[model samples]
Target: MNNQDDIILRTDNLTKRYGGVHALEEANFTLKKGEHVAIVGDNGAGKSTFVRQITGVEQPTSGDIFFEGKRVEFNSPLEAREAGIESVFQDLALCNDLDVPSNLFLGREELLFKFGPFSILDEKKMMRKAKEVLERTAIKIPNLSNHVGDMSGGQRQCVAISRSASFASKLIIMDEPTAALGVQETTQVENIIRGLKDQGVPLILISHNLRQVFNLVDKIWVFRRGRIVGEVIASETDGNEIVSMITGMQGGVHEKASYI
Candidate 1:
């Protein structure tokens, strides 16, 4: 079992290179259990690249990843999820034709029975579980049977978040989760994030919206030119200071607190 004070995820000298291009270079980062962290950067700041390496969408050119006090190497996204790390990307990764329950149990559908060579989906069980999960997260979808394609952007985003939260046992990573959402929808998503914090679920959020970052996360990790330029406690800093750090206008004061 992981202690509350344990480092849930840590990257040491993490780097990724494509030929001569250095997408991410020597990033040392840590996320503690139940801590909410935000990754912010301008375009091409290697934010997505960092997420890709950790999520097993791509291999790091060099470095080590430690999770829950154990070193791990995830060869695919499935491996990451199996290790109790769930990510909800901007795309949401839902089947437009499927309903909420189907999307929630997409790849790992519950099996009702197996006959010879066929196994059937336990959809009723999945639907019940889905409703429970949404309730736990304080998320309300008026119709769980509605197809994803018919739902509004915010509803779709909530479905993706609900799926991740339902299955995630260790950490949850969200990439621009509210970028396409309207004000009301964004508020709804923020409430879900707050609910996660109250539940003591560690989260890593990647976003460019400074207001949301300041409101939702405890710490901010700024990336610039393929490198992590700074890590600031949200309570001690503001958007201007973070923006300066991102633009390399000022040197970041490295906090003396132990990171990993």
Candidate 2:
């Protein structure tokens, strides 16, 4: 059982709808501090929708979101970030033409000097901070001055993950973080995640890779047909059991399942 005081994020009866179709339904979920959890299911199973609502990419049709013991209604992703919730979507949202430091700072650039109506961007400061952030996350990018467009898929993914980790004070949400990477690159990203875990940072990972999910997270939340079918402790359950839960083959175990 998880202590209520340790809960960093909680959703009560969370639901989302579009016209006549329900994208998500009545989800009661809790994530504790420093805990890593995975959300997995087949396509159209509401995994992305649930994440969108939580990250403020979209509003819930009904229900409440509680973060760090306070009820929150995030009007935008910026608001969510201000509340210490950062997300790295599969799209990456980085400017390919920009350099590493620029991409890391993106919309939140720093200003160092001002003259009249003109202000100079703090490029050096941004680069220094970017290096610090990468080092802290144990992310290795051989060339920090190269354009992201020229980088490999895994490198780009690492930049996105690093950006999220740089400012995230509470939780980081990653959607298909390693879906497009090679084996070596995937290992690098996974190592970065492990570094986050070592630092006691909480994370929520959404992925179709059952192996990665089982290896990286402590708990698994199975979603099926817009609803969470089960929550299983990773150490206590196998991939087959999780697959069974996702397909609805196993019933009546969700309520009684023990989760950390």
Candidate 3:
């Protein structure tokens, strides 16, 4: 087992409920420093619900979240981002009317005068920083002036990921990042994910594609009926075993993979 000091994120008995519906229950999860982990489950299996709690999109009914070894309860997604947890939700979250640079610095725009809403933005500086971020992630975009809504699906996805890569200091969480892209576009996004791994950034990916999960992450966590059913080392397990865990099929391995 990794030392406690090596843990980047952890949750203990995290639970969320709405009236009689329990969206997530007793989720105990962890991600080690520089490790990439995938969360896989079928629809309504509490995968996104778990992510919502971690990213501060919604508060849990009861739980504890530890980041960098410190307990925290973020009041909002903005607070989570400010605390160095960046997320690329399935929607991409880019403003349709904004150009590349503007969207890259959306909520955290670079201001010239530090005035509240009246301050003038340093467009040139923001563009330069955006370029550096894209270059570092090896993302190629032809024009910075193009509106995000006008770009291809893959390019827009890259923009969202680049925004996260630029600002995330501790960890990155991605939900269905390549769900709607074509083959080439999916490849592009996957390559960017690999780039993040190469940079030693810890990531928690929520995906349905077992192939992609095996390709990109070091470990997999399976969720079933609002609970984590199993955890496995990606290299030590196969898709069949993961599928059985997800579906709870008979004669399938349900035990956690040996980490030692």
lDDT of 3 by residue, 1-260 (tens): 76999999999999999899988999999999999999998899999999989889999999899999999998999999999999999999999899999999988999888878899999999999998888876657899888889999988998999999888568999999999898988898898888888889999999988889999999999999999999899999887788888888855644553211
In terms of TM-score, how similar is model 3 to the real structure?
0.94
Candidate 2 has its poorest 10 consecutive residues by lDDT at 251-260
In order of appearance, the predictions have TM-scores of 0.91, 0.91, 0.94
lDDT of each: 0.89, 0.89, 0.90
- Which candidate order results from sorting by TM-score in descending order? 3, 2, 1
Cα lDDT over the full model 3: 0.90
Write candidate 2's Cα lDDT for 1-260 as tens digits.
86889999999999999988898999999999999999998889999999999999999999999999999999999899889999999898899999999998876778888664477799999989888987766656787899999998988998999999888568999999998899999998999899889889999999999889989999999999999999889999987788777777765446435422
Candidate 1: which stretches are off by over 4 Å?
1-5, 114-117, 251-260
RMSD of each: 5.2, 4.4, 3.8
Candidate 1 per-residue lDDT over residues 1-260, each given as its tens digit = 43535888999999999999999999999999899999998889999999999999899999999888788899999899999999998788999999999999987888899764478989899999998988776656888998989998988999999989888568999999999999989898998889889999999999988888999999999999999999899999977788778777664535342121
Least lDDT summed over 10 consecutive residues: which range in candidate 1? Answer: 251-260
- TM-score for model 1? 0.91
